[model samples]
Target: MERTVYEEETYVGLVVRESKISVNSSLEQDDNQLDFDLKIIAENTGDMLIIASYSNNTMGENEAVNESVDISNLFKANIAFRYFNGMVFSCSVYDFYDQMPLEAKIEFTMTKRISSSVTNKDKWEMFCVFLDETRSTWSDAGMVTTSYSLDQVSCYSEHLTSFSVLMKVTTDNVSVENSETLSLMSTVCV
Candidate 1:
């Protein structure tokens, strides 16, 4: 699965929607600070992942991070596949109602669907992104290969019990700057 985006950004509120997350940084301005735009999209073959970010200050906030993970052991730790990098960012709006910082939150959601098979073999595949934080953009860092193991097929009585996908989330704000790594695996048998 893949996500397609255009340069135009719209106001979608503080929470990110399902399937796609949009961040509108162009509306904010700072005379002494450098300006930047942040966007993120996550996709999968049989499921969906959602991530949302918010700010802790009244003036709002901006973040940038890079994440990467490896899960090739499912098909025998083959270097040809099972590893990827993705970019993530979140923003929080300033609320004048009470005058205290709103705690930052990151949300992730996964929805299930039927698995896809190739040539009568069930294969799990995911297309992810890698970010160049220096420029705040996505790039194709490598190619991914997929295969099924004979032992993996024979073990669960010819049924695959679990499948995994890689995800990375990062934040580069002064208050909190760090990278988040995750390996998302589905235990649903297929």
Candidate 2:
């Protein structure tokens, strides 16, 4: 068996959705637009991770401080999503180092197929898996890689016939090391 370690230093704050118009009709004319309005609500669930490292110092009799360091660790965060039955279609990650009010965003899309009977109030479930870089006996050495998965369920509601979804991952941190230190990985269905 192989041991896979999760990188928690990456954080996903929230997923947001927007609406885009495919077609429109006016006086003897037709047009289309891609627009989205952010909605705020509760009652959704997702997962997140926080990876960090820290150092400790001890005072010695020689009037000097002894420092101790530990390897980076992972912390998991539970996230709630408003919709269910959606998978991670795409993803992008950005990093800002040594900057105040640090922030980043992950944008992805999702789709689900189900019967024509689902509603907004109906609950659904989805799964997301993130893989970190590591070595495996099955492959050669000196390979740095990462990947993630998104799973979603359908809410068969009578009010809606079809649903197309987009997901956004945003984060804000006061402590960041450097910009251009971010990476992204994604999985999509053809």
Candidate 3:
């Protein structure tokens, strides 16, 4: 019983490339369908393809997970265990050399950058917080599902680990290349 192959590192830009492909970690469709999809195929590195999917539905009673490292069922709600009401890291960035398909989101924010006389900026809003390093505390990540199009931004995670997207910046001259928040991270060569 030896099947050990786990690697994940995908960062596009600034030259850090390594593409490996391997799929089928209990590839679910039905039969309880507690999906934990991980698709990391960044091979050849042309045509620019970026896709990340980690899902769940929750159903646990026996307890024994290790399908290439299963993060249980994340979190939907927890009584003792059996969690999974949300978890989706959907990212899509297809730039066939500026063919256009770049608006994929992965924002982790601490929010700070507003100085143009501070005009309120229509009450800025952007939230997706969850950082409970054991007990440091920072709640509210019960996002069952969130979707958006015109480039793509689908954040559906009831719980994971290390999360931040809490932005409430009052618009005013916020420059830094539009506040400079662009992310695309991946790690999976397992």
Candidate 4:
């Protein structure tokens, strides 16, 4: 038996993070542990990656059968990153070729610009979002669009000024594929 294969493109929605930074401070505390948790959201876009696998079979007169299987599919996801400096980073569609059958996850880290006079007391916060396509009407539209309220932060003290933001993304079942099948029939008369 033979099978037909097809590829389809999908679009994912936007992911949003409430807050990217958390801080703790005490007047009389000598030692403290700061916990920073960031939220990440991924949208479902039709433009995901997909792969296909198939096998072929053959039969011989000696009542023996042989089979061969191979992979024959590939897909890519395009992601764009925007920074606070009005700078944008573009990631091209990467092939979803892996040993394990799972989705692809992409992570990004950004460094915050700080002045030399800044000290430890000063606090800094940053966040990031992704967009599918570029928009010409508005600069923000080109971006996946992060909330200002979510990306906002206040400096605790003037001592701390320099900081950086790291963004992580995970996608599930983005790549899909089908397997091929083959059948053989043989007869012998003595």
Point to the candidate with the largest TM-score: 3
By TM-score, how accurate is candidate 4? Answer: 0.20
lDDT of 1 at 157: 10
For residues 40-155, write the lDDT of model 1, one tens digit per residue.
32221222222222112221111211223333223222112221111122333222233332322222211222122122332333432233345443333332312222111100
Prediction 2 global C-alpha lDDT: 0.20
For model 3, what is the alpha-carbon lDDT of residue 177? Answer: 42
Write candidate 3's Cα lDDT for 1-190 as tens digits: 1123222332111111123222222212222122222233333344443333333313231221112121223321111211122222233434446545433223321212322332444333333445445655434446422532222223434333433232233334444443332211112322
Deviation (Å) of 126 in candidate 3: 22
By lDDT, the better pick of 1 and 2 is 1
Residue pairs in clash, model 1: 54-92, 55-92, 85-129
Regions of model 2 farther than 4 Å from truth = 1-90, 93-103, 107-109, 114-125, 135-190
| lDDT for position 13 in model 1 | 18
* Model 1, residue 3: C-alpha shift (Å): 25
Model 4 off-target regions past 4 Å?
Answer: 1-83, 96-103, 114-125, 132-190
- Tell me how far the alpha carbon of residue 138 in candidate 4 is from the true structure, in angstroms, after superposition: 8.6
State the RMSD for candidate 4: 26.6
RMSD of each: 20.1, 25.3, 19.6, 26.6
TM-score of each: 0.20, 0.17, 0.21, 0.20
Judging by lDDT, tell me the better candidate of 3 and 4: 3
